[model samples]
Target chain A: DAGITQSPRHKVTETGTPVTLRCHQTENHRYMYWYRQDPGHGLRLIHYSYGVKDTDKGEVSDGYSVSRSKTEDFLLTLESATSSQTSVYFCAISEKDPQETQYFGPGTRLLVL
Target chain B: SQQGEEDPQALSIQEGENATMNCSYKTSINNLQWYRQNSGRGLVHLILIRSNEREKHSGRLRVTLDTSKKSSSLLITASRAADTASYFCATVVSNFGNEKLTFGTGTRLTIIP
Candidate 1:
């Protein structure tokens, strides 16, 4: 409902394979964030971008990387997929402050075998 | 470790009854927000309560924050069948302009229709 869409709503890949998930927003928000949701572990932030080409790591950024080359597109990449990386990934956008309410996309379900 | 922990992983109630969910955190926070997520879908922002504010109301939703106890609660009155979903509470902590949000595992609410 926020004009945000995540590509490849469902994906299954083998371990050690490279996988990239894309988040596109039409709101032209300045802040974009990536999070992963797992059972019993809640949602953990993977990475976020404040502006074009500006990014930062989050609490669970161990095996994930993000890039925001443009205002509307934010990409999350897993250089090598692992079984532990299997989870539902969500992308969120905020107009300005990180402390404000965020709008989320539909989310992508990834499975690593 | 700053993640909020929501009580009662799952709850079931009648459609017209009220549902209350509690969240507790371990650190000082700048603000707290509640979100709702339908199965296999993304999260939607519900309400927000700042640390300095004791309570805030939005429609049928009421959010209360107690900084002294490091806890927050969400109350939804006159629940509807469509209100059945997983509710999450996220905490925002800031340190030197770097703010981080940690989400709880979420409480799954089912309204008996």
Candidate 2:
């Protein structure tokens, strides 16, 4: 599993509430990414971190945020959840090299109602 | 707005048969990668083929990249019921780091026993 883990494998919450998901990795990879997958959408990049405190928005970054304060942990937060945000979230890590392969975490399934 | 798009949104095959999926990308890329995901699960890395490389193989999987056509193909030979899953192709452009991956919509494969 590439030593990657995501907490709260399944979660259900009501709209307008705050939610946070955690991704931890044993490997000290330099890059971490958060993505959301839904039917017919495959996977859409939400946010990515190149280094601690250095992050960038992806194509679908609205309503979500990410923080990487340490090399081993990356967090995704939803300031105010909405039903449209319901999807499976995955965290992936890769080496600093541009051509390195990415390893994914088990994923967190979030449902907002 | 997806950089990569896959054809045949779904595929069905019997055990011991070969399953082939195609992915087309809109722009030039440095490399392409394939990934597999079981229903309601995270994605697993499969194979990667660089732009300079035409084909690659790992176990029962074979990947072919055609840079001129901006496309790639994944073939799982002698597939099994366990191989039933969704397959996606990701492309890495000329980005400096690991932020290069752009995933396709994916193809859902059903392996009938």
lDDT by residue for model 2 (A7-111), tens: 989999999999999999999999898999988887888998888998999879999999999999999999999999999999999987535688999899999
TM-score of 2: 0.95
- Per residue, candidate 1 scores C-alpha lDDT tens digits across B2-76 of 469998899999999999999999989999999999999999999888888999999999999999999999999
DockQ of each: 0.88, 0.68
For B1-113, candidate 2 gives per-residue lDDT tens digits of: 78889988999999999999999998889889999999777899999899899999999999999999988999999999999999999988886554468888899999999
Report the number of the highest-lDDT candidate. Answer: 1
Q: How would you class the docking of model 2? A: medium
- The runs of at least 3 residues in candidate 1 whose Cα sits more than 4 Å from the true structure, single-residue gaps closed, are none
Q: Which 10-residue span in candidate 2 chain B carries the lowest summed lDDT?
A: B92-101
lDDT of 1 by residue, A1-99 (tens): 599999999999999999999999999999999999999888999999999999999989999988888999999999999999999999999999888
Locate the minimum summed-lDDT window of 10 residues in model 1 chain B.
Answer: B1-10
TM-score of chain B of 1: 0.97
